[model samples]
Target: MPLRDLLLGLFVIAIWALNIIVIKVGVEELPPLLITTIRFMLVAALLVPFYPVARAQLPFLLLLSVTFGSLHFALLFIGLEHAEAGTGALLVQMGTPFATLLAVVFFKERLGPKRIVGLLLSFAGIAVIAGGPTLPSPLPLTILLLSALGWAISQLLIKRGPPIAPLALAGWVALFAVPQVALGSWLFESGQWQAIKQASWVGWGAIIYTAVMSSIVAYGIWYTLLRRHPINRVIPMTLLTPVFAVGLGALLMGDSLGIHKLIGGGLVVSGIALIVIKFRRAPRLA
Candidate 1:
């Protein structure tokens, strides 16, 4: 990456890093699923107007919508409701290794010793997190990890499918996700209307920030950088997200990170470093 694009990539990473904190605030005011539904709805409203559909990719596109946009965000928001923003950021990077493992299993991709070590370090970090005092409970961590797995599966699908325009696909994914997420919210989450009606500016602002900044603007910048540079060069910049997440959570939200978090977060970042450094990388979570 050139200095300019590298700086642009860093800009996107900063936006994404702060997005976890935004989601944490949003979930506090609205039902998690309902908030997800609204976020996608807002994204769809903005993007579908300009992007044309790729009819050939509809099936896979819908799959991406459900797995990446719907299930990923739904579980993520729910997990964040119980978990801190900083911890959610660290744990979600597990998706890269999860996707690598899935590739080994289903696509016959090879994982060398270093990647295996990375996997162990990553999971061990999660275990340490489970043992730590920061999280509300083990259940929220499990939900967050499951969300990571869903993200991995989505990346696998995208890897297998033929190429499509990133923005068009993103718009379609948001459009398709609205219904799936809205249906899930309608079925499992209550007070959707009340939450929307009663929500303050902070709640609505968080939704707009996530929908516009996190999803549309950040992804647009990311795809632009990917086009301008090698994937490996651009990918490593994402590691900063957790760093920003942990820092912002501590500074703004007063979320405590004890010694265990430092140890565990270090292990997770080290593992991710190993994976991105030595091997084929996965597409990042949106």
Candidate 2:
């Protein structure tokens, strides 16, 4: 990657990292699901005008909307309601291993020694977090893990689809996701009307940041880098997200870091690095 691309990559990672903390702040006032709904509504309104017509791909797009956009965010924001932003960021790393396993089972992709080791190391970190004395609620963690699986499933679904414009896909997915999230919020959550009425400028700012910076700008930069370079070279930059999130959480949210989190987070990032780097270096199958 060029220096410029590397810098852009870092910028996206920072946005995504700070996004976790922003969500923590936003959900503190508005309901998480309502925040998600409004965020997607704003993005969808902005990009739906530019969304390419993909009538043939609408079904897959809807599935992507549900799995990736709605269910994923629904579980994630709900989990973030209770879990620390730093810990939630670490747990979301499970998406990589989940995607790997899905590939192994569904696409018959081989899991070489490094991937197998990576898988174990990743889960080992989870075990550490789970066994720690100061562990957060298991239910929230479980929901977050399921959110990761939903994200992995969305990746697999996207892999099966015809190539589509990144922003268009994001837009259409957001268009479809708005209703799912809105309906979910209406059914399961309360105080939506009250939240909107009482929401402060800071809370709304968080939503706007997530909608604009995190969703549109970050994804645009990410796909641009993928277009310019091999994915392996670009993918590793994401490892910085959790690191930034942990630091930002402590600095901004006063989140504590215990021994278990430090050790476990290290192992998780290291394991993900092993998987991504080793796979990038390995010979392509067939």
Least accurate stretch of 10 residues (summed lDDT) in model 1?
272-281
Model 1 Cα displacement at 230 (Å)? 1.4
* Model 1 lDDT per residue over 1-286, tens place: 5688878988899899889999999999999989998898898888888987767879888989989987688899999999889999988989998998999999999888898898899888877876788866779888898899999999999888879777787788988998898888899999988999999999999999999999889999998888777888888888889988999999999988888788888898888888887455698999
TM-score for predicted model 1 compared with the true structure: 0.94
TM-score of every candidate:
0.94, 0.95
Per-residue C-alpha lDDT of model 2 across residues 171-208, encoded as one tens digit per residue: 89989999999999999999899989999998999999
Q: Model 1 clash pairs?
A: none
What 10-residue stretch in candidate 2 is worst by lDDT? 274-283
Q: Stretches of candidate 2 above 4 Å error?
A: 279-286
Each candidate's number of clashing pairs is: 0, 0
**Which of the numbered candidates is closest to the native, going by highest TM-score?**
2
Q: Name the TM-score of candidate 2.
A: 0.95
